[model samples]
Target: MSRALKATAIRLTSASALAVTVLTAVGAAPASASTLTDGISATARAENGNGACAHGGYVGGPNQSSSCYGGTTTAHAWCADFAGWVWARNGVTGLSTLDDRAASFMDYGKKYGTISNTPHVGDAVVYNYNGSDYADHVALVTAVSGGTVTITGGNQGARPGHVSTNATSSYSVGSLPWGQRISGYVSPAGSNTPSLPNPASLPAGTLVKSPNGPDVKVIINGAGIPVAASDVTPDKYDLSKIVLVDDTAFRALPSAPASGTVVHDQAGGANRYVVIDGTALLIGAEDWTAAGYNDRADMGVPTAWLQNAAQRQLTTGIVVMDQTGKDPKRYVMVDGAALYISGSEWTADEYNTQTLMGVPGEWLKAAAKKVPSTGTVLMDQSGTDPSRYVMLNGAAVHISAAEWTANGYDKRSLMGVPGGWLASTVSAQVSNGTIVKDASGANATVYVMAGGVAVPLSYADFTGFGYDKRPLEGAPGEWLVSAAAKAAPADGTMLLSPDSNTVWQVVGGKKKAMTADQFGEGKLSFNDVVGVPTAFTAKFPTV
Candidate 1:
């Protein structure tokens, strides 16, 4: 027997007992009795045994093998499958294009030109669709009573993954279960689509209200976000654009405002928030000007809206601190993380010159502290420590006074950092590519650094290699003694014989002759060739 006939037989055998149960579940009996010709609504009702079907499992439940599962070997999220099966059984065209994903119904509706915001009996309701992906859920609309939409879907029980009727899972017309909003409704192909207000048709920032309620909302991104009457100011919102809409039309719009909107509580509070990805993050008073939020108009929102919005750390690069003065430490926000900056360092880096945003003490305390970005020059300002350092690959490397002066680092601004962080740095040799000679040693030999080793340069080679044009840093006598072992010029160094036009490219400690053609192909320029005495060029073997 067909499933619909079986449902009828069951009802006929126990009509008295089932009638009371159905009435209690539905609050009132449906407008019409169940029949095979009733379309998808009848098929949906029969499959769930009129809200009596339950197996107590999310997957592999007794309903897994039911018609709602679409005969799959393993149970999956079956809400879409159930809706699709009901529509197909009721002779809806374009069922072949439907899939097990809730979003597929939306695609089918759009392809068949049957998708709209209005709900109708036998239409499929899609929830939480963000465009180009599977929606959260789907259900068959069994009834569209005033202010309420009754739907029958699978995997929707308290335990989930079970077939059920609208009697167990009905919702207000505009909202869905679990805080989800209806993305759209999809009617069967060739069916007469219902007419409804399109929120997208309204211009953003227009003030609107429902005739049934005095509460007003501002339209933003196709959604009506409630704004407190007292909070609406003529300076930010135009009073003439406020329009009254029917309750149903008003409810059809989504409730959340778009990101970057500035909002404050309508009930009158000093607290303000900025919407980001649908959540409101608190913006302290000091941050309003520093973060440039003054540029955005402030909207008064319902108190409930602020209460429901979850707070997260602000993702910005602004400088922030505690306004209470209890914690005088200031921090720079780097990708949502905070890096504490000392007072001296703050002034030296000119952060003191910029506007500082003061946030709540509790929020500043909760922020995660991270290291400063690389390339920052830091010096320990404490009278006990005199070491200066530079940030490299996340760690601080010590820079000697001689090297600092030789490199003209005295001209660069120094950030005063905590002595504790400075103690973590290692007193290592100067970085590669630096020209160095002993600061106090009698040896006047100058060397160019290459991978921590020093390669000696003659007076002629120094000027020829263009090293004379660059800053020659001074190194400690101890470091120079260890690093100044006799070695050839660094690999890739182009050498020119002092008395001849011969040019050689250094490779693996050997010199390779370069032809005119080879030099042009390699993009070698005569300016880069270092002129060395015949004895220096003759030391390395020719390759």
Candidate 2:
């Protein structure tokens, strides 16, 4: 409840005679029981709606001058008079002048230990007059800074009806009325003990800032400095509910969370981020304060805004991706990390590579798939059909000599490992003795599947490519090579001719030589896609 209401309740509870008797008996009471807050509240209410205490017309001072104290005359100093009226309203009796009453009240507080001279919030700051007989100046301290009181007073001199900070002047008492000299302090009633907030009870990393409508800046642990009202989450926080996303790119206080701390996606309009640590996450923000800076948090006017906010560019660990991928584009990053680029702007290399440039559907499917513990695999470049030379783990699946191009390899449909396994048709002769090799005639493994099971390709299973005639050797489920069969092209028998380097052979009876465009668009057989924590095991060998 407000101080005025508390004082009113106190007055109502005691009988009029009893109150007078108590005051009379204890003419000099301690400042401990004094109500300085009550006095200030009463003064604010009186000055708010009525001209009785004309606030000195927005001159930036707390109260009006004495010249305008008596309901508009602007002659008498208004600070003491306002205090006098407040004192009277609080039922303080026998007070003719505000000046004398204020001093007497302070004197009574000092004599009885009811008040102190130190200034605090809601304290009546008494200023002494240099040449006057009595204490002539007073104001209500709304806030205190560096132990100096910012007062709301009136009727001292110029700017007579305004509120100002550290108002000390010639009219001030006990000392020269300068910015920070205090004559004496009057203890306001019920102010000695305040309900302090218990920090230990609050959650660690709790947002401890202003809890009211007016903007408030908070300093946490004397290190994490203030955050503005507009920047901070606009809400009141009690001791019970406070822990929230801290020092992350997306700034927010969550009512309920998935983790002890989960980041916000307010900027990207999507809830996804690469959490650097529990204390920080890389999220897209339209207005990020830490943009292009190391020390994100600071104590000063805020001037930061985010642009190009998105979640696809983030990783879970260290940031390594550059905005531009000129030559060295591919980045090996952790599943979750903050990725930064050299330029102010950058995009994923997968989105711009020449081999995978126009594959939007492939890109989406790859990204949307679950995270893979192992690396990614894409189809080789020379193969006409993506399913022809598939990528099992991170190596090429040697199907047949024709399945691979003469000079270039094929890897078009290689993005996501859906379901953990892939399948493709191979010529039966490939199971016989026939091997594919690099441009330098170096033998390369050719993977082949029989009985719907995958196997590694090795020279022991099939003869090296360009060999004339070989016989079949292994069973359908086992890795084996046979002797040379009829050396004729059949269904799905890919043949990479030594003549034209850039051509694919995919036909029933006749072979067709297709261009690069025709080669990349071929069909793919995605067997399965797997997320993390899944295993990939196979037991066949292809040579």
Tens-digit lDDT track of model 2 for 237-324: 3334433211211112221221112233322334322222222233334223223222222212111111121223333322233222
Best by lDDT: 1
Report the C-alpha lDDT of model 1 over 1-543, residue by residue, as the tens digit. 112211211110111211110001112112231222144665566566422233322222112223323333324555665676565544456666676667777677667666665667777777656465456677777776677666777656543245666532434334445455567777776422223244446777677864334567777656787775544562255667777654456766778876667787766778877775566767776667666677877877666657777444444446777656668788765434456776666766566775676555555665634444444566764535777666543445556777676655566667665454456543433344567776544568987664345667888778876779977755555556666563655677777766678888888889898888755546877666655557767888998
Q: Model 2: runs farther than 4 Å from truth?
A: 1-101, 104-123, 128-134, 140-152, 155-160, 167-173, 178-183, 192-260, 263-543
Q: Which stretches of candidate 1 lie over 4 Å from their true place?
A: 1-194, 201-218, 221-256, 314-543
For every model shown, the clashing-pair count is 2, 91
